[model samples]
Target: MPQPVIYTHQLTRKFGDFVAVDAITFEVQPGEIFGFLGANGAGKTTAMRILCGLLSPTSGQANVAGFDVYRQNEEIKKQIGYMSQKFSLYENLTVRENIQFFGGIYGLSRQELKDKTNVLIDRLGLHNEANKLVGALPLGWKQKISFSVAILHRPKIVFLDEPTGGVDPITRRQFWDMIYEAAHDGITVFVTTHYMDEAEYCDRVSIMVDGAIAALDTPAGLKKQFNATNMDEVFLQLARGAKRGD
Candidate 1:
């Protein structure tokens, strides 16, 4: 098997006396859709931040896209894409301009930026709205644009923190289609979400209870192991015992 795109061994994080992430270990393969799920403050965000190089781990080891998280954070940033729960696009800029701006940040050359911009606009069926301000577009449009921009650089891994929230069911389904396409193109997707139905779409999922992973397995395996009918039941079975509520 190929080297895992993400590897963590006893990764942990702390805030003063409290342990936000407690020695979690896992691996995510290339083009895999890995779900990181948890309730309010089960340390999911902390663990993800450490993996994304936003926060350093207090102990243990983590390597993302072949770079050490503690020593090569800047390099990790270049090799991965991230989409936060809140939209990260510039509302004031036109759709085309936003794409250009982010693509530029990713170090795309003038011609490369232009080419990518054209391809994205055409692919997303946003030709008519390419020149429109992102603020004026609907939530679904903004979500799609945000996702497109996140992967515009073709990073090895993309971390999505609830990339689909508050949109209609149809829009959510469409958003997932984009995720599937990204994975098919060999982009590893590391996503965190509270949506159980969405969790079922992942290739593998890890559920964090408090500050540790309580379960990690494929959807069907988790269902069989927990004797649950769906992802929702499995999540409830584990998350119900969590000590933290943040």
Candidate 2:
């Protein structure tokens, strides 16, 4: 059996009296694409932040790459890459410069950074734009570059928070191809998105509502479980049920 790359036990996070993530538990298998589905304010981002070691869980445990989120945060950080909903690259830097800067931070040697930067530039089809300032790139290209920078270190797990948000449908499809390529290379992808169609691309998905998981399964399984025709219908049915219970 494949081992889980991510594991959480009763993971909970609270802000004063408001519970942002309430005792949720799930595991992401190695090399799998795990989609986290939720409406706005459903705590999907909160849970991801906790898993990425950006936020501490108020209670319970989270382990990424075998490092405990609370006690071994530094190890976890070294083993994982995270791309937030917001673009994180330095707009003032050239595309190549941005790659070098991030590679440097990951402790890649100068020579190694140069080699990897060249490889990434070619792979992402940014060779012509390598010298262009990142600020001048289009939204789709900027998103692609941001994603490239996030994985420069080749971490064991990569967390993407709404990585394809606001892009055109074609761009989003291309972005998912990149994600699949990563997963095929043995990298575990944990993603959060509002797009039901994208959720169908995941190997498995977990839908959060009001700080808890309302459903967890493959997209087909979820559709079957809800007696729905598709992921959109499945999501709608479960989301409505969750709202009614709230």
Top of the candidates by lDDT: 1
How much lDDT does each candidate structure score?
0.94, 0.89
lDDT tens per residue, model 2, 1-246: 776889999999999999889999999999999999987888888888888777899999889999898988888888998886585789999999999998999888988998999999999888789999999998888888888888889999999988998999999999999999999989899998878899999999999988999899999999889998889998887787665243
Candidate 1 C-alpha error for residue 16, in Å: 0.8
lDDT of 1: 0.94
TM for candidate 2 is: 0.96
What's model 2's lDDT at 43?
A: 86
For model 1, the stretches where C-alpha displacement exceeds 4 angstroms are: none
**Residue 226 accuracy (lDDT) in model 2:** 90
Instruction: Estimate, for each residue in 144-223, the C-alpha lDDT of model 1 and write its tens digit.
Output: 99999999999999999988888889999999999999999999999988789999999999999989999999999999
Error of 1 at 33 (Å): 0.2
Who wins the TM-score comparison? 1
Models 1 onward score TM values of: 0.99, 0.96
Worst 10 residues of 2 by lDDT: 237-246
